[model samples]
Target: MTIATDKITYSFAEYLELEETAAYKNEYQDGEIVPMTGGTTDHNKIALNFAAYLKFALKGRKYNIFIGDVKLWIAQYRQATYPDVMLIEGEPIYYETGKTTVTNP
Candidate 1:
C-alpha cells in the first residue's frame, strides 16, 4: 500500500507550539506537518563522519558544523527541516528568537 499523506494543514504558529513539547521531531512544509522517522545506520554514519571530518579540518576557522536536531528555516517556502549536515560560516542567523531554528546556513 502507498503511504498516506496528512490532509489537514497546520499554521506555523501552531506547529511551533506543538513542537515545543512533542516527543518526536516533525518537519514543517508549507502548511503541512510531516513527521520524521528514525534515521538509518548508513545515513547516521555518513552524516556523523562528514561532520567529524569537517570539524577537525576546519578547526580554527570561522565555519561551524551542525548535525541533526538543528532545524533549518526556509522562510520563502515556509519549510523547517533538519539537514543531515549543515556548515555555517560565522554566526548562524536564527529564525526569530529561537535557537533551535536557523535561517542562514
Candidate 2:
C-alpha cells in the first residue's frame, strides 16, 4: 500500500528501494515513511551501556544482542522502526529476505 500525502505516496516496496539509498533511516508507520532523527550522545551512551551489560550477562548463552540500526517490524501496528536494543533468544526472524529487519524481538 502506498502512503497518501499531498506531495507523494510510496508503497512498502518503493519505500524499501528509497531506504536502501537513503543517508539516514526512515521508519514505516501504517503507510507513511517517517525519517528518523539522529541520536544524541546520551542516547547512544545509554543504548551501548545497556547492550554491553546484556551481552556480558548472556555470555555463553544462546542469545544475540543487537543495538541501534536493527529494524523491528511490528505487523500489528503496520510499522517498522529501529529499536534501541534487541535481545533475541535464538535466531532472529526477519521481516523479509534481508537481515536488517526483524519480525520478532
Q: lDDT by residue for model 2 over 1-105, one digit each (tens)?
A: 998769566677777788889999999887889999999999999999999999999999999899988888888988888899999989899877998888888
- TM-scores of the models, in the order given: 0.87, 0.87
TM-score of 2: 0.87
Which candidate number would show the highest lDDT if scored against the true structure? Answer: 1
For candidate 2, list the clashing residue pairs, or say none: none
How close to the true structure is residue 45 of candidate 2, measured as C-alpha lDDT? 98
- Candidate 1 Cα outliers beyond 4 Å, as residue runs: 1-6
**CA lDDT, every model vs. true structure:** 0.92, 0.88
Tell me the number of clashing residue pairs for each predicted model. Answer: 0, 0
